[model samples]
Target: MKGVVILGESECSVKDFPDPVPDVGEVRVKMMATGICGSDLHLYHMDKQQAKKRGERIPGHEPCGIVDAVGNGVKKVKEGNRVTIGHWLGCGYCDQCAAGNIMWCEERRGYGGAIDGSHADYVIANERNCVLMPDSMSFIDGAFIACPGGTAYSSMKKLDVRIGDTVAVFGLGPVGLSGVILAKAMGGKVIGVDIIKERTELAKKLGADAVVNAKEDDPVKVIRDFTGGKGTPLAFEASGSAKGRTDIVSSLCRGGKAVFVGAGSSENVINPGQLIGSQLTLMGSFVIPLWMTWEMVDFISTQDITFEGAVTHRFSIDKASEAYRIFDEGKTGKVVFEWS
Candidate 1:
């Protein structure tokens, strides 16, 4: 089997490796589509020590595929069934797992980050992590459900977005756009903000009530002004930038809640006085629970949200490196690795 291996910064190659066999309770999935995520790009240009720590890595996390073979004890899915595996394979027996927060399990392992991910033709997946895909969704679209969809869903649930409430998303990337759709579906008046005009326009198409061009205007003031000077009751900071984090905090009304969803930054400096005085609640969200992921899949099947538009670029497994380059340059929406 052919697979991708990172040689160093800005370097990757197709290396031949032995095809994997499913272990007990595991299933072998024939790769159909895999997404190039933002974190994968960050890991690509790791400064020496970081590179050494993640030496000889295969980078891809948003994977969707069909079951090719099943190991003994696998029964939820059988051969020839299409499915999307959850990115995090958490211990199902842990206390966190009992509370439906499997992503925080002590034995948590991600498909693409900790081990070999789906940047190739085949991947071994635990049967417990698989989510059955609706007949209406394509494999490429299903790829987005694994990570971006799940993460966005988790963030929305964490904030408990109410119907008729107001929301401002501080980025217009794939995850941010997903937030716009989810917020609107929950009956919230959605406002999207981004420096990129193209992304902001896409947010409008996705049902955002207003769009703010961060480069041309002050986002916090503009959002507040648009919201009748009261600011949005809820805000989602989906850009992993210091400026984005600051803007989200400043654009909140008294007692407003903000959720931080994007990754790629290490440190965020925020004001304690403002938080204390405003009585604002700030929450950081990560991966969604398996049950929540299933709910998201059901919503996608019934709602107007479509992952087709979110995926703007496609490449074969061999061009994985080029796909990563395009993602790193921020020139595309969701670049997917399409396997035949």
Candidate 2:
């Protein structure tokens, strides 16, 4: 088997490894496509602490593929089934798992994070973690659904932006772009903000009513002006930048809601008086609940939306290092690995 591994700080290489076999109640999935995410970059840029913990794990969580083999007790899927692996691996009988919130599992584990992921010829997944996909869904599109697409859907649902409402999306990365697509699909007038010209233009092409180059002008002002000098009632912060977060809250109308969908470790400063005076709402959302993600896949299979178009680049597994290099450059949209 061949798999990608982190060599050191900001370094990675694809190396030969022993093939993975499905354990009891597990399935062996041949990787068809694996989407690269921001978390992968964090692993690629392994700091000392993360480096020690990453160990020999393969790096890729957004996996969509065909089942190649099944272990004892596995019955939900068979060898010919096409499937998408959910990011979280949990104990199926736990209360959390029953509630479809595997993210809160005490025995919580995840692929491409603490475990060997699908950035290889094959990966071992528990039957509970796999979602069988319909034939109508493309492998690349299914891959995106496992992460960015699911995250976007979950966050958008939390925002609950109404039809005809003006929504401002801060950041034009893949997730941010996903926000624009979903917001527009729901009939909201969307304004996208990003310092990168490529991303700003891409957002417009996807469905944003307006795109702001935050580097050149104040995003809050631009969004306000676009909405007839009144700020948007809804804002999504997907850039994970402190300035973006602050600007988004300021870019919202009084009594408006802002959803923080990006992952970050830094502390942010917001004035209590400002929040109270405006009666604004700030909600922080994390990953998609496993149960909801399963339903989302079914929802995706039925939608006419072009989620696959979000993929901006595709590379072979052999060019694993190059794939990471391009993604690390942060110049592209959802990047996926294709298997031959």
- lDDT, residue 106, model 2: 91
Model 2 score (lDDT): 0.85
Q: Tens-digit lDDT track for model 1 on 185-285?
A: 87889989998877888888878899989889999998889889987789998898888998899999989899998875677567898899999999998
Candidate 2 colliding pairs: none
lDDT of 1: 0.82
Model 2: worst 10 consecutive residues (lDDT sum): 300-309
The total of clashing pairs for model 1 equals: 0
Best by lDDT: 2
Query: What is the C-alpha lDDT profile of model 2 across 1-340, one tens digit per residue?
Result: 8898876587788889988889999999998988889988988887756776667789888888999999999877899899988878877789998998888889888888778887888889888888888888888867877888878888888888788998899988888988888888878999999999988888988988999998999998998888787788998899998889889988988898988988773876577887999999999887788778777777777766656667788998888888888888887888889886
Error of 2 at 63 (Å): 0.9
TM-score of each model, paired residue for residue:
0.93, 0.95
